[model samples]
Target: MNYIYQDILIENGDVVLDAGRNPVLIQDSAVIAQDIKHAIIESGLSVALIGEKSRDGRADLKKQIELLVEEETRLVPGTVTLEEPTLGNIWIFAKTREFGDLQFEVKEVTN
Candidate 1:
């Protein structure tokens, strides 16, 4: 089974998940990272990989994600922010987490 973070469209400066009935705000680009972070530790899912690829804080986020993945541990609650969205695929479930350079199926913008 596959779980999709539906109603999320990352435009220039807009990234938010409709989440259907509940409007989930993505705020900025970091929002994606925040969501991944929440989905991991809070989801009760194990981590496998996490890291960033930039000269900014992004690199730090990447490293952190990777650490959690390798350690198979969850980042303490409220350790990550649900702000902007990150660009990449962060794999996490009820028991594992992995980072990949692959792209997942995101619904096309309809409006």
Candidate 2:
């Protein structure tokens, strides 16, 4: 699959992207995450949604990540091999609910 790389930034608990793409209005991080998952699955991309960390020290990041990915994919980071790069829409959702900074990358894979 070919992928268009996009970077996402979360500041003060809001999602922002470096690109000029239209912003997703849903503020709930979990719902936004689901939107991204749906976009990926609907596009049949060879990409995985991952959660790196959380602000709450006691939060179960692992469990949260597990819930995000579900049983559909387990693609590890840096393991995707693309033949040709192509542009496509990738919905990215991030949460910075604890006054912490967050960053995410969305690989808009094309098959």
Candidate 3:
């Protein structure tokens, strides 16, 4: 059986509304991306508490994110990567079943 996921669209911490002032609904791959985005954003525990300055902390954070994404969404295992381009910002790259690739940036978590 196939499943179709649906959710309200959100951007930059705000719900996206259509011209009629109703929340915009997204389906399928877009919903998957949104779910991934929420998982990353809501995993708000400080990396410092997890030892962010050390290699172990970074690895731990990556593994934690991978687990959270898999737990929260229908994304296939091993398809998510958490990258830090600069300090305090994580870039999440993932692939959905139908969508080729999805990327999200999580910014400014206190280190």
Candidate 4:
């Protein structure tokens, strides 16, 4: 599953993530984390969405993260890999009330 998607709407803790194709795993490489943060920030969503592969959870989560030493801004820190984890296509939610049982579409970020 590819981890690529696009953010079409974000406001008042609500997101309309137009998802598709999944995202690209960018670990231990030179794809600056701040850049990713900037992308998300510019995309207008402060909280990062997280969802496990084999959980009975929805795809609209909001995560409050802490910052590391060198990294600017903050991030939804990585966790123990899901037993059947699918990379990149991290799910997002605002609240159980705000967004429920919805998978936003992820569009490509064309340069």
lDDT of each: 0.37, 0.36, 0.70, 0.29
TM per model? 0.24, 0.22, 0.68, 0.20
Candidate 3 local Cα displacement, residue 60, angstroms: 1.7
Candidate number achieving the greatest TM-score relative to the actual structure: 3
Q: Which ten residues in a row have the lowest lDDT in candidate 2?
A: 78-87
The digit string of per-residue lDDT tens for model 2 on 11-91 reads: 333465546675643333433344445544454342322222333521343234334444323233322222212333232
What TM-score, to 2 decimals, does candidate 3 have? 0.68
Off by over 4 Å in 4: 1-31, 47-111
Q: lDDT score, residue 46, model 1? A: 25
- The lDDT ranking, best first, is 3, 1, 2, 4
Please give, for residues 34-80, the per-residue lDDT of candidate 3 as tens digits.
76766666766324423567787777777787677767446666787
Tens digits of per-residue lDDT for model 4, 1-111: 432332333332344343663442342211233244345545433323332343333232222221221132222233211111333333221111222222222222333
Q: Which tens-of-lDDT digit does each residue in 1-111 have in candidate 1?
A: 333333354442365456565446433323344444444444332222223334566555545544553343323332332222333344432222233222222111223
Cα lDDT for residue 102, candidate 1 = 20
2 or 4, greater by TM-score = 2
Arranged by TM-score, best first: 3, 1, 2, 4
Error of 1 at 57 (Å): 0.3
**Count of clashing residue pairs in every prediction:** 22, 0, 0, 21
